[model samples]
Target chain A: MKSKCSRENKRKLENKLFKASSLTLTLISFFTVIMIFTILLVQSKPLIMKKPLSEFLTVEWAPHLGKYGLATFMASTLFTTAIAMAISIPPCILTAIYLAEFSTPKVKEYAKSMIDLLAGIPSVVYGLWGVIFIVPIVRDRVAPPISEALGFIPVFSAQNNSGYSVIASGMVLAIMVTPIIVSVSYEVITYVPFEYREASLALGSTKWEAVKKVVLREAAPGIAAAVVLGFCRAFGETMAVLMVAGCVAKTPTSIFDPCYPLTALIANNYGEMLSIPEWVAALSVAGLILMLIVLVFNVVARIVVIRTAGE
Target chain B: MDKRKIEEKIFKYLMISSTAAIIGTLALIIGSVIVKGAAEVSVNTFINDDVALFPGEEHGILHAIIGSLYLAINSTVISFLISFPVAIYSVEYMKKKSLSPALTISIETLMGVPSIVFGMFGLFVFVLVLTRGFTLLAGTLTLALLELPLMERGIEEVVRMVPVSLKEASYALGATTFETIKNIVLKQALPGIVTVSLISFGRGIGEAAPVMLTAGFNPFPPASLLEPAASLPLAVYTYLSAPGQQGKAYASAFTLTIIVLIISLISRYVSKRFTRYVSR
Candidate 1:
């Protein structure tokens, strides 16, 4: 009877221990989020307090001149991400459609695995590929032809033919994000009910018409979520963009001109900034902005996902 | 009828071509990396530590390879320990009440935060404030944070996949809840947990930005967790950008790619095998 009582006490103790440990682990996420905000705010306080916020809104980013305006970097980030989104969305949607509605099981399996592998490739590898292959291709083959034909346009009027421009980085970003967009959209599209397709077909619509008119409409919100996720991914990408985007800290006048996005700016300059007065603080504020932007994107994406998944 | 037929045909062709384009791009990226890197791969590249300093001299990334393994293994182990418990708590202990949706949202948000931002956070908090300098421990902790969401979500899915009947059977035999979870639930989820850890390992190894900030650049292998270390991705980044070191960069990238690819392939294989087991 005494041994049985001891065993019961031991079991109870183990249960309490496991529960306490698990609860502590679960709270770590909360702790991390709080810690990140605190650290960023603390580090950025120096710059935020001394510099008028208006100074940061200017177009130039010459740190040596005490001008830390983020206009150029913001424009560069938006421009490159816009180009990437424009180029990647159509192909990604089509691929998702093919995977969800059309491909044979064997073909889908192989294609899906390939896409996963593509997604798994490290960003540095992508950057290296951009340096070696994409940059040269853009410089030698794509840019010259475009410049010759459309030189009248301000965006194509650059005399220099260096491939490291906003467009090349955008293209690399497109390649980097295509798999993500395709996979997420594919999941959303596949979740769509088969009965919707059947009803459309039964009502005399073709498979293409059903997919276009009914299925696509139903899955539009989830697809939008996927695009937003892709945008977030492209916006924060550093290494590949830094390698191919020419790292110029100016507002790009043309697609052919070099540019610097917020991420590339931070990655390329953070090391040297530590020694410069107020530079580290300025960089921390930029990091804070980037984090907030990504946070908003993620929150919106989550809401859309939950609503869609709940349905 | 003819218009509809043409529209269908056009759409089909577009989808086929787009799918083909995706595959083509993947093939092109991997193929080019292999072809360019093959020339630079040599026995010396694996053994020489001064590869990054010399433009054309015989050198290798031995230090970087070891450092990467050390970082990846340490971070994965730490992340697993933290994430596993959280997964079990949220999935099993909560018992259908489900942890607050807010917690899930926050975890997802953290996952979406830019890695560069994480690097900055690590730089400010760990590197500067806590450690007072770049160190391997700072990088490892930052990486553990990065892997937390991925590992937690993965283990949650795995635990949820554990059939309820097994737990019920254990309880019906007079097992306590903790006893049932420790034996029946975890035992069934072991393969999936392993798969999740390996996937996180791959992610931790491939990450460069966070490591670059928290772990200062050092060509030599680290002697302790407090010392600075060179990671494969950081090495690749440095070498690739350095003038005249392009060969060494390609070689390092090739090595990194092979390691990442192997981890991914193994994880996929394990998941596939376990999925079969579960279905059976």
Candidate 2:
């Protein structure tokens, strides 16, 4: 009887210990995030305090001239992300629709795996491919014809047609984010109730019409969330963009002109900036800005997803 | 013949073309890597350590390959230790129902934070504040942070899939909650845990930016956790930047691709086997 009582006490103690440890581990997620944010804010304090907000928002980025403006990098980041979204969203949606509605079971299985494989390819591999294949294609094949036909437009007005431009980086970013958007949108589209499709089809609608009107509308919020997620991804992509975006720290005036996104700027210059006064802190500020933008996108996307899921 | 029919046909064609484009792009990337990388593949490329130094000269990435594997395995193990417990707590112990949602959102946000930003965080916290220099340990910890969300999510999904009846049976048998979790939940989720670990390993090996900042690059093999080490992605990035090292870059990319593909295939196979066993 005494031994049985001792065993019970030991079991209870172990259970409590395990529970406490697990709870602590769970809190580490929150702890790590707050720590990262605090560290970035602290590290960037020198730059934030020294430079006026107005100067930081100006278009000039010549740090050598006492101008530590980040407007150029911010503009390029937005421009590339916008261009990437424009090129990628329609195709990604269509692909998602096909995977969810049109493809056969066998086709879906293989195609889904293929997309997963695409997603798993390392960013550096993408960078290498971008440099070797996509760069030349953009310079030799796509740019020349576009420049010839649309040279009157300022966005296509660069005369030299070097492969390293906003368009090249944008295209690469588009490809990188396609699998992410397609997979998420596919999940959302597949979750729509079959009764909606049935009701539309019973009303003399064709298959495409049913999917377009019923399924797509029901999945709209989820698709928007997916696009936002993709945007967050494209905005923060570094190595591939650094490899192909020409690393020019100027606001791009045209799609054909070279520009540097914030990520590319940090990745290329972080190591070298350690010795330069205020440069490391400036880069820390950029990092803080990137984290904030991504956090905002994530929060908005999660709210959209959760609200729709609840409904 | 009607307007509706024309619109439907156009939409169908558009979807088909989009699918074609996605698959075609995948083919183009893999095909180009294979084609260009074939010329540079040789015995020397896999064995020599001076690959980064000589650029276009005779060289290899053996040191980087080994270093990447070492880091990947170590980080994955460390992350699993932390994330597995968090998964169990969120599923089994947390009282407030709202806390789970908040936790999930926070983890997703962490996952979405850019790799370069994580590099900067590591630079400040691990390298600068803690270790006071770039080292393999700092890089491993940074990658562990990066892998935590994915590992936790993977384990949570698998644990949640465990049938309620199993736990009920354990409770009826007079097992303590911790005992039930150890013998019942974890045993059943073993395959899933393995799969998640391997996936994390693959992610760690492929990451470049975080490691580049926290783990100082060295051409020579690392002698200890505090020593600087090279990684496959960093090697590839460096080679791509040098004007004459294009061939070496392609070779390193091909090597990295093969390693990533193998890891992915093994994980897929393990999951497939697990499903088969469960169905049986």
Candidate 3:
């Protein structure tokens, strides 16, 4: 009875209970993250040591010749992602600004709801549209015309029936990522002090000019952070990429040439690759790259947010 | 000069046009998918494995529909079982404790963990290790983890919204903490919980990744707990991407999209109805 009732015992009991839950929570999150990274690391351990992990830096991908290189994949992912970001970020920022600083209440509600609805629409459906609509158009008409018009450009040289071209992939990614950027950028744009706009306008600047010169500069970091979220999402996105990215494992000489994304390799073969450990290795390598890219993107966003907060 | 009048007119038109354009595009997407899906949507699809690729073969989506329902139901049940006790303990009894903040942050962290990463986790650990068991049971458990944080967070919110006055009244009436929770808090939180529950179910139904790994897509009704069953999202994914099934894939996508859209729409309606009630 005394043992059960002891103050020391009660304190110990409470401490144990507390420790149990916190530890459980920690383990759960850590377990999930660690599983993703560790599996990648474990799978890539041999490859990491073999080609000095520098092959991803230097060597061109020659698949049939047994060159397990990532230069092509990385370049393809980065180049088109850059194109997509360039396409999306400006329009997304403009939309956010228009929604936040300009729209009336009814307009704001309607815009936000539409954005939400679009965001909720599955990436697979987006893939179908890209496959059924965009790819054929690009292959049949646009690529050859672009090749003729911009024949000197190294990136538009080869035109294949590779359904989802880099441009198509980039376009789909931009659309997929737009809602996220708009939502976040609009949120940050609204968080800007009304005085920033009012002060600039009072100084004889037109409303648009004030928003451009003052409001845009003030919310630059948040907008950049929003773009980074879009980047992170786009980089890690697998399903739509699998369908729409024209999964040729070659590096693109032109934006018209098809290239497999890091995620597509895994999503395309995650189940069937149990037969081929090489594909497993490839997937794990892709996962590692994906995890690193996303981690860096999120970290960049966080740092920007922190720096902006102090400024 | 009527420069200001022109500016006003331009701004009004721009605002109206932009708003209408955004809604119109989204409406088009939603409407097109429904129409496309409804074209192939049949009672046969819901009740049999009859897959109609083109104008010829009439295969139903019975297997996929059952699999979707089973996975969603199992995940929801598992999440509820795991979350409710922890929720009750945390919201009611553990409110005074120091661990609440830590637990709250943990939940937030889980919420931010990406869905694809969850798929990998399920693949490596649940499907591979603990369960060399890559059956529907494994899939359900994997999804249970996915939905647990969501359900707990929403349930906690609903529970917290219950008034302290009611709790005090129950206490004054000689009710215990457990009694107060059972009698007063739960009933009031029902609508919110129910809505959130539907939302979680909808979310789980749409999850293609973790299910992809844990439940290998077997295109038949699951005969046992260990048997693999095909699901709508997975079917849509494979059929759409896999060679020779592109048409059927589109049909599957249309079907899955309709089901998910309807579920979300209904849940959103429930939330609105509950909000109206709570406001009064």
* TM-score of chain A as modeled in candidate 3: 0.85
For model 2, residues A91-184, the per-residue Cα lDDT tens digits are: 9999999989988999899889999989998888888888888889899888888888988998887765789989989999999999889998
Off by over 4 Å in 3: A1-31, A46-51, A56-67, A199-205, A275-279, A299-311, B1-24, B50-57, B80-114, B148-192, B241-244
The candidate 2 chain B region of ten consecutive residues with least summed lDDT is B50-59
**Pairs of residues clashing in candidate 2:** none
lDDT of 3 by residue, A13-41 (tens): 66456445634644454355445567667
lDDT digits (tens) for residues B1-280 of candidate 3: 5675566456656645654555565676667666666776666666657345577656766787788889989999888766665676677766456777666655544554555666766776777776675788888887888887788888888888888888888889866566677788887787888877887887788777678778878778788768887787778787775777555566777877777777777877887787666521
Worst 10 residues of 3 chain B by lDDT: B105-114
Q: How many residue pairs clash in all the candidates, one count each?
A: 1, 0, 5
- How much lDDT does each candidate structure score? 0.87, 0.87, 0.72
TM-score of chain A of 1: 0.96
Off by over 4 Å in 2: B51-57
Interface RMSD (Cα, Å) for model 3? 5.0
Residue A304 in model 3: lDDT: 68
In model 1 chain B, where is the ten-residue run with the lowest total lDDT?
Answer: B94-103
Which ranges of candidate 1 are over 4 A from the true structure? Answer: B51-57, B95-98
List model 1 lDDT by residue over A30-97, tens digit each: 56776787788888888889989887778877777777889889899999999999999999999999
Q: What is the DockQ of each candidate?
A: 0.76, 0.78, 0.23
Q: iRMSD per model? A: 1.1, 1.1, 5.0
> Model 3 chain A, poorest ten-residue lDDT window?
A22-31
